[model samples]
Target: MNRQAQAVVLLLLGGAVLKASFTDLYLRYVKEGLRPFLIAAALVLVVAAVMTLWYDLRPAATAEPDEDHGHDHGHGHGTGGGHHEPRVGWLLILPVLGLLLIAPPALGSYAAGQAGTALASQQVSDYPPLPDGDPVRVAMLDYASRALFDKGQSIGDRRVVLTGFVAGGGPGGEPILARMILSCCAADGRPIKLGMAGNAPTGLAEDTWIEVTGRYSDRVAKDPVNEADIPYVTVESWREVPVPKQQYE
Candidate 1:
């Protein structure tokens, strides 16, 4: 395509990025902190594209008549003026179309199943007593770390609530609760899995968000894929819930 066509593509690309960054759609791919960067990059693309279009498509100054010939040949975009661009450049439009039309969802259970569960950090140590609540909320990572590294000493006997999506089950068919944690984007995301022991829910579809109240149980299982640790909890109750605004932690 020529400069004008390239400018149109560039404009569409900018619009796509701006749309994603301005809405919750961007969270599906990159961390929230990168929204500002996305917006900035989009603005730069838009400005550059507009400038290029203005320079390339604007009316050309009419040339003065030559002294000898006294003729005024028309001067505008000529048949041979088009730039030769690689066909591969056209592929960029595909992602732009997807972002503008159908925004993809955040990583979930099926993604979790595809990769081996990553163990919550092994630096487990004594945790301070949980704050006052009938059932204190505990992060999945914290629960896993304490359960695996500290042998549940920090978690103690307190009833804790955990939130994550249902990711099938363990090797023995025990129910599993999982959350994907990302350092930057979904490409770098990893799943944290916890096996449910008692009173666990059943038959929930993959990616079903849930909140479960359970006491920490001293149990651990190996991930069938890579033999990584999958912690355990003895669930007392559970209920389905809507997916959170921020699916990944």
Candidate 2:
């Protein structure tokens, strides 16, 4: 391929990658720390383009034209070029294509209890009663923060919306232990626990994406292992969904 063509192919490939959900992960994890890597990748394509142009501009190599084949060597797939033809870099495209085709599942049990853990020490007195019929949407992080900030207060029957990746469940799952991603910082993160309600989507597993809509109850739900200290939320509705590109964006 010529220099212009190579550049155009690379540019298109990059644009497709940018459109993918994995691109968000790339920005979060790789872009922040690897400015030089991006620069180097660009520079490599530039060099390939320049080489292609130079090859095209130079005198064409002449091979004997055959009567039947009619310029077999000269007018073959080879355009104005040196002895070499540009090779498609499939290896470079492989990973990018894989990510675009199939996004990996969200962080599972390994990072479940660890990431965005809900607060367990909220006090009973601070929570206000749930309004008559208002639908409240609150980020898991925010809810966790409120719990920590007003441990002395009660988070009464207020309708709240929580979003996060699923986590903290076994193969044979329980209604509780749903997970959510916090801000970039896991320490500040919070995952709300749902009390056994209606059957959750069975096919979905931990680290699956979901949105949980429910009213907060003042009653504290504790973990069985540590009955003394467990934070829980009584769930009214749980719905599985695609993981949003921006978990904390």
Candidate 3:
């Protein structure tokens, strides 16, 4: 690749990063906390591109006659000043093009299906009491941990609200309320799901975001330590909701 091509690639990549950061699209792939770092990286790439263009377009000095070599053979393969540019640099454009044209959607039910629920073992601690509310809004993962590990002591008979995308087991089987948990980005994301009891909605489209109001059911693993199949929620009510801005928890 030529210097001009390198500069253009840098500029395009930098612009894509800046656009994703400014438009909040970065949240689809990465955590919101990475916004500042993304912005800084975009600035650095833009600066480097500008510098490359400046140096490339500057005036060049007149070439002197090659009196030392004494041979006039114009073979450009000589090792004196010639440098080979790697062809692999062209691959950089693939991501830029993908970002501009395809613009992949955030991970949803399909991804959740592939990465089945794996609840992290909760450490023994004085779990806090549920907040004061008729239907306390609690995360799906939080509800699962509380119900499975803490034996739903904090939940008691309190009604709670859990919000997540509907995944798997709905029509023939019971519906599963699932949320993606990400440590860094979508690539490292995994799903946490809670099985729903009672009357679940029928014919709900996959990945449809919904709010479910329910309480922990008595049906639980006899041995809590055994990898308990997803904890059950005795759903009392449910309704479709707009997909949240941040898809992952």
Question: Which candidate's TM-score is highest?
Answer: 1
The residue-level lDDT of candidate 2 at 218 comes to: 39
User: In model 3, how large is the Cα lDDT of residue 242?
Assistant: 96
Better of 1 and 2 by lDDT: 1
lDDT of 2 by residue, 15-130 (tens): 44445423454443332334456556656655665666677578867655465377665478765555423466435556657656756544444454543334455444454543
State every prediction's TM-score relative to the real structure: 0.87, 0.45, 0.84
In candidate 1, position 95 carries an lDDT of 83
Clashes, model 3: 0
TM-score of 1: 0.87
| Tens digit of per-residue lDDT, candidate 3, span 194-222 | 77788666678889999999988865432
Best candidate per lDDT, number? 1
lDDT (CA) per prediction: 0.86, 0.51, 0.79
TM-score of 2: 0.45
